[model samples]
Target: MPDVAEVRRRTWVPGRPVDVLATLGPLRRGAHDPTWRVDPDGTLWRGVRTPEGPATLRLSSRPALGEVAASAWGPGATWLLDSLPALLGAGDDVSGFVPRHPRVVAAGRMFSGWRVPRTGLVVEALVPTVLEQKVTGQEAYSAWRRLVRRHGEPAPGAEGRLWVAPAAVTWGRIPSWAWLQAGVDGARSATVVRSVRAAGRLEECVDLDRVSARRRLRAVPGVGVWT
Candidate 1:
């Protein structure tokens, strides 16, 4: 068995209020997803499948200290901990956004703590996008939730039962029937399979600017604006 690792007590304080759930909640494939959880104490936990391996993370806010404590376990423990701040929206820049309307400004002020998070895992982000093509949100989320629970490796930590998205190779190898069973049509399934076959190239585009990345993604067969 591969050795797993654990890192605990790593913490940081953001300049503004960090609504843990609000910041990272959108990443969850579904409301009842096992990959995302909230503890009784309000700590947020997430499982991710990294290039290295599967990892699980727990985050707790310390209001008095104005910081968030992070703990992670798996072969990707260090990567998860190191990227926690960014995953929690530290790299988001709202300087470019200036709300003109009163309602927009008010909403921004009301949800000041909310920020869009960038997971940095391109293929992970792309998989759901592919699934959602020409389908309803509920259908896409259900397919994602079911597929991940079935094919993904169990997370390393004992904190909770969490599972990561299967590796790119595993994704590429999924049988056509499985996608249908998950409510994904053959066209979308073919696109995802082909995309994962070139996952290495797609992942490398993370270093590229937005335009270049989009162009590269569009070059793949069956991937376009819908994807």
Candidate 2:
């Protein structure tokens, strides 16, 4: 609805084998996540709220051609397309990783194409992760699905009922009743609200060292070792 136009497209040929799904799979909150979908034809669809705006991104791997074709729609289409390589793990460095155990070696070989994706959206990653604290996967995922579906906007060009997660300000403004209705407890909801309120500082963690990032994250109330 935000002045969406004809789809913007890009083709990326990574120097290493990129397992798009495996790299991005960890981002999916659950099977019923409103922000993620996989089509029958093996296309991966994601609804994201980038710094520019909301966008719908589609990715399909062309094994024969050794390329991945990506397309996007909405105000943030260009931004999403521009970040595709990093989002698909182009920045991941595994040159020093050495698998010592037999199982580790086997898994490395099995998932050689898999790389850790760097989304660089700290608030987006943190909110749901906070919800998952001390709860079963089912409960956390259910609450996440409910909250996103209720507060999020429809993705511009998603084929089905996909949505982009609410912006940080919106997350902070979510009502207590609304959070309760979504099965999120007061403590968890409070953490989410607090995290979003300090989103600027949290986003800075992307540029900080590992120790500093962890220390900063621990400063937030209700966030701990497990979180």
Candidate 3:
């Protein structure tokens, strides 16, 4: 195996209290997901699928210190570190979401750390979703776990064995039998294959607004309103 890449670190203070879990939960595909690790100390580790290469990111917040520390490894480390703020919710605008009901206001206040994180990687969002369609959660998560562990590169670092999602080319090349063994049927597998084949165009959806991105994603076969 190649020598592990260098680990890099960055730190910053958020404008408001940042709840790392609330912000990052959506990124975790499932409980058995191979792409993320959340330690007991509240640190969040994620293996990102980037255009440059696989990147591993570790984030920990020190409320008393008033800062969140981020560390990255692998070829895309610099890109991951630079995009930390946006990943951690710096770009979300909630000015228009004032809750009218007392219960809604209380719920919002209770989860003040919640923020929508926009990860520009479209295939990252679409692939697992396709696997999830018309399947039990257990089946989908198991397939994701198996495929990633078998095909993905180990995350950079001395600790966890997390793996980044395989690159689009790798995903596109997974054999038909492999999908069957993973409990993914032909329909779902076909959708996944199609999505990865069109990854370049799907990625461009990131540049579009939410409405346009959704429209673009739906244009891909097997992706529909439910997705």
Candidate 4:
């Protein structure tokens, strides 16, 4: 692991309030997910596999400073810093979304700081989503934890035992016996392998329109409306 002196750092001030928790919380697979963690002091840590390489990112919101402080380490440090704004919901456009219902209005007001984050890593998102198909939350999370901890790499600068998810090629290479041992069925495991094999096409969905992206994803054998 690199020392703090070798860390790359950045600060981002969004035009609107950003709820760092709400934005990134959905990405956590479970309380024990090896890819995500929350420190006692409320700092958020994430281990991710960027196109460049693996990285460990630490984020802290400084409301008084009206900015988010971020530090990253590993070969992917620069990529993580460059994508910080989008990962914090800077790309979310809610200007035209009108809430007419009373409950909707109240909910919006209550979660005003919340925005959808875009990590732009298709294989990272898809493998987990496939694992969750038609399974209980407990079952899905267990499978995810098992597979990642077993196959993934230890995050570069993580304070604890956080891990970076396996790359697309790694996901494709996981054997059937390993998948079954992780509690994943043949169908779901096949879907994951097939998706990772075509990871290049799937990743391009990030730049496509919603309709086109759905079409491209649905073209895969096991992917459907729910996936």
- Please name the candidate that would achieve the greatest lDDT relative to the true structure: 2
Every candidate's CA RMSD: 2.0, 1.6, 1.9, 1.9
By how many angstroms RMSD does model 4 differ from the true structure? 1.9
Candidate 1 per-residue C-alpha lDDT over 1-227 given as tens digits, one digit per residue, 9 for 90 to 100:
24564455588888778888888877877777768888898988888877777888889988788898998888877788888888888989888999999999999998887888877798988888888889888998899988987788777874447777889999988898898998989998888998998999999887899999999999988889866
Candidate 3 achieves a global lDDT of: 0.85
Please, what are the lDDT tens digits per residue for candidate 2 over residues 52-91?
A: 8899999999878889999999999999999999999888
Model 4 lDDT per residue over 18-37, tens place: 77888899999999999998
lDDT of each: 0.84, 0.91, 0.85, 0.90
Cα lDDT of candidate 1 equals: 0.84
Worst 10 residues of 1 by lDDT: 1-10
Clash tally for model 4: 0
Selected candidate, larger lDDT, 1 vs 4: 4
**Which residue pairs collide in model 1, if any?**
none
